[model samples]
Target: MSSNFTNTYTIHMLCANKYEDILTQFSSPIEIEDLWLAALTEWCHSPTAQCNLGTNVPPNSRIACTDPWYSKLRWITLGYHYQWSERVYNESKVGEFPSLLYGTTVNIINFLKHLIEGREISSNNSSRLLEQCQNYTPEASIVNYYRTKTTMGFHSDDAEVDKEAPLVSISFGPTALFLLETSEAIKHEFDAPLHGSFDHVLPIYLHHGDVVIMAGKSRLARHAVPLIFFDDDTEVVSKGALRVSHNVCDKIVKEDHNEGVCIHCQECLTYIRTTRINMNIRQVMPVHR
Candidate 1:
């Protein structure tokens, strides 16, 4: 749960602790933990309902498209479904998401904004990136689950129409090595080592309950999660692992668990007891009718 950054784009890392902090704080319904649990429960059950490239894929299409972990976490659209072109459609072709998911989306959006207020966002596009986030309301969320083997290629999240808004990312489970490219040049350095030239790239170790907000110039900058270290493999596993195994990790973790501390539970501990989950929430402007 270490955080580092230069004066370029502002990357705020919230909750520099393990997943146990997330489970404890978010377990209470009064603290909006129920919203996160509800969203996770709905997606795990509705395996085929995750968002895709939105071609001719039907509402019940099982095609995972580009994302292999789509079954664990799907795109839950509140107002519209996002297309491959980065635009959104008002039609509920992919069907609407649950109320709990929508509520959780809003909560994350506001939390991100609040966490990075007044922070300078290095952006040549416009100077008001942080200003825009002040009033931003996210309508779409890309929920993702990851195993030790899963690796995300370098990419920027510029699909939303409102590019001014920041991206809110929440991490759970094992620690991960996250990469951020500072240069405007788009380089797919997925194979590069964790540490790149300090001038161009910054490396971060993201742990469970760590919240990252990429706003302003950093919002559009290229980033990726190149490596994930699961708890089972690491010498020291987060205390949250015990909570997840015991079925006391709130509603979502319990629902995903089986009888006792079963290792087969995908939510509890799959992929040799090393599973990670991330929620990337963004704002998609609705097309004016």
Candidate 2:
């Protein structure tokens, strides 16, 4: 933990002249991705259903996602009942998580507290969030597994009773395109691409071990993932496309030259080529509050 490098990076300033600072690339010595994958397989057994958002899909569509199923993970949010809901219906108590998962959750929470105290978050909403984060004890998590073709629409996480707490997102496997936009972008009709001149969208390339803390005003900021780089367009140059890298964390291939993907992470990257895993840990305060 002491050897980690955490800092604030501003994507861009909004029209209100307020700069949104996101905590990105907060590194840690522990193999976070490995822990995430292990917990994913151990906890989330039995294939679940895909997100049925009432979108039309042709019966003969060849896309793998046309017949999609559940690829996301959760902490104590088991059972087929609350699949799409934000927080676990009956939130697990503290220390109820597996040894590895609990440790990781606490480590992240502490890191966030330190980050907020050390830096100055610009938005008033975030400043208030920092106060909640200090005393925040997370009860559940929603971990989503995604293939290259998987894409989630623009939306905000506002279900928790304690809306001030930020959403902590960790990425594992190949990089993907993450989009963040202003509240103005939340319209009745969602166009895949931003239309007109006023569409305020910022595209971010989230890579393995990359941690994004969406707190403060950024928490309410509408965001989504439109595309993922599952193929070798970015990795292969002279040679033809390479097979997916090994999935295990420690195992590394000798010939991966991607700029961001590191050798230590290649084991998981190569194996989980067309897919990614995301763990979003959050605190859901008591209902009475």
Candidate 3:
């Protein structure tokens, strides 16, 4: 924790409009048929999912999604009840030893408490990119997703958390294609490029180590996940194109009064033990009234 986020890059971005400085304050934008400018290809997987999932095909694979299974903001079935993640659904909480590999890479919960109450909280530094999320209300339990050729569909991050505040997303795995649109672009039209003059549609190659922050006016802006590509037009450049990341959230599931008591029988008890990893960082604010 201390080592991972000992630096103030995340808090700096939160307080400062550094992200806006990148796209707006910068000069002309350049496009290419053989280069990835937005994709930051850096190696920062502590215990790497590849090492965990064994680079398998079906049951061994995993999807690090940020939205629930039913949120259809961008006309996609994101935040809904779906039987995804074998390890998660099977009540298998692997990775017991808390190495600098997984678990809330960059924690915003401590940072917010530090800001508001001048308190210092400890965290882990597993090279997980910090995505600081803030809001004017409470948040639901977070969720995860991995958008490849299949699995999850096009959707928005606003489904799990409150729709008022913006979502701070960070890319952590292989490079994948992402499409972000607006309400006007996908209000009622067909799936033809999500038409609209105000379309912020982007086929972002969310490569490893890259952090794409969507906030402010673009927070509620409708977005979607399109697809990913392996090779470009010609020669093969690099070989890191599997986009995997988690949105750290402030949502925590408080157990019922049952606490240590078992509510269901042994069969049901064996089921609801393990939970899905919906690591999303949410900005929670107290009620004014």
Structural RMSD, model 1: 8.7
Stretches off by above 4 angstroms in model 3 are 1-148, 159-161, 183-200, 230-280, 283-289
Residue 7, candidate 1: Cα error in Å is 28
lDDT of 2: 0.49
Cα RMSDs of all predictions? 8.7, 9.4, 18.0
lDDT of each: 0.50, 0.49, 0.27
Per-residue lDDT of 57 in model 3: 16
Instruction: Write one digit per residue (lDDT tens) for candidate 1, span 38-61.
Output: 333445445334443333233322
Query: Once superposed on the true structure, which residue ranges of model 2 sit more than 4 Å away at CA?
Result: 1-29, 46-96, 120-127, 183-198, 232-271, 286-289
lDDT of 2 by residue, 33-126 (tens): 4454453344433232112332232232111221333232213232222335453343332224345655665666676666557764444444
Top-lDDT candidate index: 1
Lowest-lDDT window of 10 residues in candidate 2? 236-245
Best by TM-score: 1
The estimated TM-scores of all candidates read 0.60, 0.60, 0.34
Clashing pairs in 1: none
The 10 consecutive residues of candidate 3 with the worst lDDT sum are 241-250
